[model samples]
Target: MAGIGFELRKMMRRDTLTGVAKAYLYAGVISSGPLILSIIGMLLIGVLSLGKVIPDFLITQFQVSVTYLIAASLILTGFVQLAFTRFMSDRLFEKRIDLVLPNFNAVVLIATSMSGVIGLVLAFTLFADLSLGYRVLMITGFVILSNIWIAAIVLSSVKEYKHILGTFFIGYTVTVGAALELNRFGLEGLLLGFVIGHFVLLIGLSGLIYRNYPSDRFVSFEVFDKRFAYPSLIFVGFFYNLGVWLDKFMFWFGPGTGQQIIGPLRASAIYDIPVFISYLCVMPGMAAFLVRIEADFVEFYDEFYDAVRSGATLAHIQESRDMMVRTVRAGLYEIMKIQAVVILLIFAFGDWLLDKLGISTLYSPLLRIDVIAASLQVLFLGALNVFFYLDQRKTVFSLSFVFVLLNGVLTALTLHFGPGTYGYGFAGALLLTVIASVYLLDRKFEGLEYETYMLQKS
Candidate 1:
């Protein structure tokens, strides 16, 4: 029994790629209860209600409201959200646990307060002139739930993620089970279930974190310096991420961008839904890889830079280079494999999926372009996660700027030329990036990063 315990402890201590894979498997199971159920529940609401009680116009409005609320929150928190993870992770990385408690406490309070303000504003919006009160209420619940969900997002980025996953799984299962039982509560039940789950998840995970990582040492105020190395990366990253979806933003929100038409065909209608749905497939990948990226950052710190600077012979450098190549290659290949499977599924089942939902107008040749772009996003983000520790920010800035510039030019031209071309904006941008990256690779390797990747060395 002691032997078995020791082996388990050893396994738990390992937070490698393989370890993360194991951890993600467990987390996936727990999150599955909520993630899958959320989708199922939404589908049920649409199907079981059968559009008779709700009406299509109301449904569409509800979706728009929910979509706007979510997008606004993400955009509003864009820079801070990027900084929050690194800020928390850096403190923990440097063995300054004391800062973490205060940091987390401040965060929770701030987030809760913000949610309250948002909820109030939403109430006004829903009640001021809208007749779809019930739908409005339900969608508001989703918005508030998303705020609480942000807490989960940040905490997961901290170290000791395996145990965090365990606690969350239990709580999530409870939420899912209870949510279905109390169907009479309507979307309120969904919201209540979510709040209950977060309460459980937050408490349980907080306890595990406290027990494992006691915050006894007093950390310096410098640790909280919001202007530290990676802190500024948030702005660059915000713009870079903004650029990634800039073309889409232009399509949806930009004036006259959606007006582009080839003969009688409109580009925005065809490009919108498929691209949006393709992004959801990214959730699983992001959730699983979040902790793994941190782990890989640590590995790179100890191995890659140190060896390269140690005046090792060509043979030794070659060996290390081989490992780096393999690491990057494997990560890229795995992401590509998953993306390939997802894109194929989307392409194959897309018609049924959209038509059944009365949104069949969202398919276009742009699907392939988006698949390629999103696939590169995951793979390159993973590779760059490792390389960023080497102080390689300029290349990332340069490349991302190029991407933005190319997309900006093309999207504007498409918008102005009165041509049916939504995805052409992304195609222009990403296509330029591909050509430039290939050329750059032939001359020299290791590209740029938009995010400040390194938290700290352990």
Candidate 2:
């Protein structure tokens, strides 16, 4: 991501207004393109289905099913996402690029097998009432989506951003077209179309990965190699993803907030909509993160760490460390500035926008709250990225754990407290987490000189 950010900054070296605009446009697309495309594609499907050949109820069912597919797939694959990323990053660091594709393939294979079994069990038992074909399609979609997510994490690390965007466009185009064309078959058709589209996406991503790292061997289980596996990263990945989704899950099954949308599936109309919109609002902040943190902070980080490793003079090392700290501060400051503008714009025009879209005014307050929370989430991500660069696994795990636990407890309390309080729990949790992260980051940087020199002696 930082690499892409650097590339964007280089392109904007002209410093013209047009150059700046293009830089951010490219940054937004590279940083959040796939997700934005997915959201738009799904929303388009929902909108276009209205007054079309498909029945309204089936469309609703399709939306609910796809929502679960996304959530479950992300959480399931999150267990392996960062671990595999670390594995590949280590291989890259060692200049053993040849090992990357094989090990990544190994991770995908393991994830697929596990998710397949889980999907099958749930599909057959929980969805036994649905047709056999529907169950099979559901399981297939879940497995494919899971693999795609894991692949996406690794693919993003490489430099084929354009190929990824092209694949997403082609894949989702197929999805919307196929779903509309196959509406005659009901929900099963929609699900099947989704599975097919995602399979195309999987193939495209896998093909690109393979092309980049061609292997003569058919399969490799090297990701399970003890030398490569980082258990801390595995836990960090799983916990962080779980923390992000925990509040939503609680809301889904909450006493008053949720109801069954499908067999053993639930949706909270009040909670889901605002949360999704909030996530959308994070795109600008995400772009800023990639630009400022990845581009600026990382450059100094490389210099500081390299100086330490090279046995440079104490003065040089201190200078590099100071520069790194400054860069981090500037990066975080940039994110806040950009996101503040975004939030203010949304707040001012949100009601009119929602009204135009036929969304209820009831959702306006929650949208504002969620945008703040999501903005804080970007800062949290920046903090986590820095921690990872420093190999601070314990801090990452602790923060993730607290995020999940605090969000759950506070959100539950909010539910008990009543309506006006609905979105505050998520906001509060994120705010506290950000404060802690900022403090820890500052403390960690302050002690870098001591840690780099004295810790080695001790």
Candidate 3:
């Protein structure tokens, strides 16, 4: 991402008004490219639901089922995602790029086997009422989607932004077109189209990775070895991903908020629309995030650490530290500023936007709250990125745990309180988490010299 940021900055070397606008636009695309595609894909599905050819109710069911597949697959594969990322990153740092492709194969192999088994069992039991073909397609889609996510994570870390964006565009184009054509077969057809599209996506990403890091060996179980794996990372990944979905799940399962959309699956129409829109609105902040933390903050971060390592004069080291601290503060401030503007824009046109989307204005307040929550979510992401740079995984693990616990408990309480209080819980949890993260980051930066120079090597 920093590399992407650097490239964007280079494009804006002129710093003219049009250049600046283009730079920001490019940043937004790079920052939220994959998510933008996903949101568009989902929206396209929603649009198709309104067509007369397929029963709208069945289309709704397909939407809900696909949503469930996405959430479940992400949660189930969360542990492996982070563990493999850490393993491969360590290997790369050690200049053992040879190990990467083999371990990736191992990770994919394990993820497929695990998700395949679980998806089959769940489809058979939970979706028993659905047709046999639909269930099979659902299970296959889930497995493929899970593998795509794992591959996509690694691909994001290594591949260029343009290549990643192109792959998503092609893959989702096929998905939307295929699903539309197959709507005659109803949910089963929609599911099959989704599977085919994702399979194409997986193949494209796998090819990119192979081109970058080709290996003759087809498979390896090296990720299972204790030497490269980190158990703490496994838990961190699981908890972090679980935390992200906890509030949404609570809303979906809550008796008052949730309704059965399909066999043993549920959706919260009122809750989901606002949340998705809010997520879309946060693209600007995400773009700012990549430039601020990934590029500017990282530049100072390396300089500060490098000064220390070189045994530079105390004044030089202090200057570097101050610059690093200032850079961090400035980066966070920029994110807040950008996200603040986004929130205001959303607020100003909330009703009209909802009207344009064919949603009731009654959802305006929820949408506003969700946008604020999503804004804080980006701030939290910036903090987490900083923590990662500092190698503060334990701190990150603690924060993720708190996010999960608070989101679950608070959302449940909000549900108990009634409709008026909805969306506040998710927002409140983010607010609190951001506050704690800022405090910890401040303390860490304050003690940077001691931690870097005085503390024994871990």
Candidate 4:
């Protein structure tokens, strides 16, 4: 992402209003386009299929099914996502680019097989009441989506943001179009359309990977070797992803808050709608994060490391470290400012926006709170990115663990309390987590010089 950020920074150098706007726009699209596209495409399908598809409940069923698929696949693949990212980063740092493609293939293969087995079992057993075609398409969509997540991680390393955005646009366009046409066949048709769209996405992403990083070998398991893999990263990834969705999962399964949607699956419309709507507001924060952290903070981060590696005078290294610290602080402050503006906008027009979407204004309060929570989530992500850059894996693991624990316990308490405190649990958990992360980051930087000099291979 820093590579792409460098390109965006060049755009900002044009020193014109349009140029600056374009840079942020590009960053937003590239950083959040795929997700925004997916959400829009799915919602568009539901909206357009209203009159065309018989039995309106099928649309809800399709939506619920896709939601579960996305949530489940992300959590399932979390085990490998960060570990494999670290492996690729290390291999690239070592100038072993050839290893990237093969290892990517190996990870994709493993993820596909694991998700395939799990998806098949659930689709067949849990969905016994659904039609065979629906079952097949459900599992197929799950597998494709699981692989898509892995593919996305690799594509993030590529600098061709245009191609990445184009692929997602084309893919989701197909999804909305195909789904509209397929609605005549009922739920199975909608699921099949989704499956087809993601299949295209996976193929396009794979092509880009192959074109960029051509490798002699087709697959390799070197990434799984003990020396190359970080077990802490596995837990960090799992806990982080789980924490993000754990509150939602509890809401969906809680006794009174949720109702059965389809075949063992359940949903909390009161909670889910506001949460999803709030997520769309994360684009500004994400763009700021990519620009501030990747472009601005990374410049100083590199200089600090370079000074350390070149055996610069202690004074020079300290100066570089101070500069890095300042950049990090400024970057975080900028991210917060941008997201604060977004939250204010949400507060101003949240009810109007919900009415426009035909959602009850009764959800307005929850939407406002959820937007704040989502904003904090972006801040949390920025902090984690800094930690990852510094290779503070143990610190990151602790933070992630705390996030999962707090989110689960707090959400349960909210459920026990009442409806008035609904979204507070998730919001409070993120607030506390972000606060802890900031404190840890400050302490880490305070001793960074000592850690750099004393903790060394030499």
Candidate 5:
């Protein structure tokens, strides 16, 4: 994202409305494009296969299978995602560019191997009742998707947004197209198409990484060394991703809330659709996040640290810290403002939107609340980004842990309270986390100079 920030800053330097639009547009696409494509592609496959595939339950099964794959892979790989990103950032900072590609290969290999074993065990054991073809495709898709996530962390460092966007477009397009053609064979066919598309996506992203970052060695296990690893970041990544999904998992598996769709998979019809639609609304806020935080906030963040490292005058360093604080506040405010407008629009027409999509308008209330929760999630992410820039791993880990705890307890209470209270738990958890994060950020900035000087290894 910092890499994309440089490109975005270059575009904004043009100092024209068109230039500003282009920068944000690119940021939005690059930040949220793959997710939007995956959501739309899945929905498109479901819709297109409606009549072609027999027995509507098969469609639901396919959707559930893909959903489980995505959720499980993300949570499983969460241990490495942020930790590996931090590793690469440190290496780049130390000008050990060659180490990045090789170490990335090591992480990918490690992640995929572990995911493959877990996926295979689940596919064969848990899905024993399903066709062997379906089980094989499911595990294959899971492995490929896991690898894709690992590749994407490295790809984010590449400046060529257009290529990244193009690769995702082609991959998902092939997914939809191939799924449509393969649906005559039913659920197994659909899973196969998904596996094929994501396999293509993995290769394309890997190619981009290899081209952009050529390493003399093919792979290395140096990232596993104690000096390079941050256990706090590992927990932060895991707990954060786990927190994000915990509420949904509660809904999916809670008593009377969800029905088993497949072997071990359950889904809440009352909860899942609104949550899915609400996530789509995050694109606007995501654009604002990348542009404001990455481009605007990071500029001052770098300046503040640079001033400290260069032993600038106290007054100058204080000025830089003030600017950084101001940017952080403004950036968060801009994200909230942008997301507010989006939420308002959704509130105004949510019933109609649900009606158009053939979902019951009864979903409108849940959708509205889910939108708010999603917006708060964007704010939460913004705050975490700021904390990361300030090197506050302990703060991140604590916030993430609190979110998981709150969401689990509150969401369970909501389940006990009934339908009317649903969605409030996730929203409440984020609201509290964001408030706490903002307070801690302010405190950190207040003592920025003291910490910089006193916290050193010397």
Candidate 6:
């Protein structure tokens, strides 16, 4: 056991950005296990419910309802992801590891407590809005569990160990069980299973976090600056999420032109659902991109640290601009690889698969649009991440605004034009925005030497 621990630490060693990058990848996988499984499970259910086990009405109901539910959840939790990430980043930058957890503890407790109260109240009141009030209740449950899972990620990002694997499995298994149980109850049941699973896993993860990371090193301080963290995070997070949902909102509102385009409201047919489902593949690429960016920055930070330590001149250190280029390349490579595989799979078996799943007719075009958009977005996301490491936050903000504004305008135009055009317009706009953003961020970071000096000086 002693030897094993030593080996584990060695394996997780990092003298460069890559180490942090690897850790971040592992962190993503561990935390996202449940979500990954749930997504696949939902996909499987999509296949089953599509062609016929469920009637067309049920399938249509499922798609629209799930869309709203997902949108609502994203809006609610979007800020959590940003705030927590910023909190972690600040602590990491300051080299204050312990304070991170205490702050997280404060955040997590407040969120879960609010979720419980709000969920309970909604479970009782919104009973009218949902034919299945139990699903709402289940969502409330997810809120609590999601908070725990987020808390766990905040901890793992700073300090990782093999114990994360065990904890992840525990939560994942619970989720599986919950899914099975909820399957029996239909819509409400599935949601219930999801909620219960998250709840159980949350407890398990919390325990794992406590057992592995104690409060011993926690700082006892009187310093408090809310602006340092929350404002930037909220800004970054809001714009990012806005970029993500912009297309969806457009699709919901825009029909555009085309026999293929299926507006969200008109997407009642099972066949039309595939277009949207194909986009989920982009997630893996997004993950890979983030991991690469993390590693590259870690290397940069280390180099900067070493250069400053030895009193190396700023010009001497400035020669190492290869890090950003490498990061961009790494991200591009991984996204291309993942994208190629998923896209090919979808192409070869898309129609038959959709048929077998009983997808409604209205969704056929949506599947194509979703898949293409997601692939394009993966590269865009990678580029944005690079810009983030470059510390061009203002540039990122500008680019983000463009994405949001353009997507919104496109959506409105599509709606004016009528039904199918929104999807294509939105996807194309997103891809274009990515190219534009990357170009601008690169320009902003053109004077890397000065930035490096400033960054190192601080």
Tell me the spans in candidate 4 whose CA falls farther than 4 Å from its real position: none
Model 1 lDDT per residue over 181-291, tens place: 443454444445444554565577657645644565423344346465464455646556667666766776555534333111123454565565555566555433432
Clashes of each: 3, 0, 0, 0, 0, 32
Model 5, range 1-458, lDDT digits (tens) per residue? 48888888899889999999999888887778555667778899999899899987899999988988888888888999998999898888887889988998999899889998998888778788878898888888888888888888887778888898889988998899888899989998888888888888888999899998888999999999998889998889889889999998999998879999988899999999999999999988899999889988889888988998898999999999898899889989999999999999999999999999999999999999999999999999999999998899999999999999999999999999999999999999999999999999999999889989998787
Model 5, runs deviating above 4 Å = none
Instruction: State in Å the error of residue 426, model 4.
Output: 0.5
Worst 10 residues of 2 by lDDT: 1-10
Q: Please give, for residues 180-212, the per-residue lDDT of candidate 2 as tens digits.
A: 777677788777777787788889888888887
Please state every model's RMSD to the true fold in angstroms.
Answer: 7.6, 1.8, 2.0, 1.3, 1.1, 6.1
Candidate 3, residues 1-458, lDDT tens digits: the string is: 24465565565566698867766776676677544566678679668746744567887887788888888888889889777877776776687777778888888888889888997888778877778898888888888888888877676455366786788778898888887778788777777777788788889888888887777777777777887767777888788778878989988988889998888888898899999899899888887887777767867887888888788899999999899889888888998998899889888999999999899999999999999999998899889888877878899999999999998888999999988889999999999999999999999999988888778576
For model 1, give the 10-residue run with minimal summed lDDT.
1-10
TM-score of every candidate relative to the true structure: 0.66, 0.95, 0.94, 0.98, 0.98, 0.76
Q: Highest TM-score: which candidate?
A: 5
lDDT score, residue 393, model 5?
94
- Candidate 1 total steric clashes: 3
lDDT of 6 at 254: 33
Q: Rank the models by TM-score, top first.
A: 5, 4, 2, 3, 6, 1
Q: Quick one: best lDDT, which candidate?
A: 5
**By how many angstroms RMSD does model 3 differ from the true structure?**
2.0
Find the number of clashing residue pairs for candidate 4.
Answer: 0
Candidate 6, backbone clash total: 32
Ranking by lDDT: 5, 4, 3, 2, 6, 1
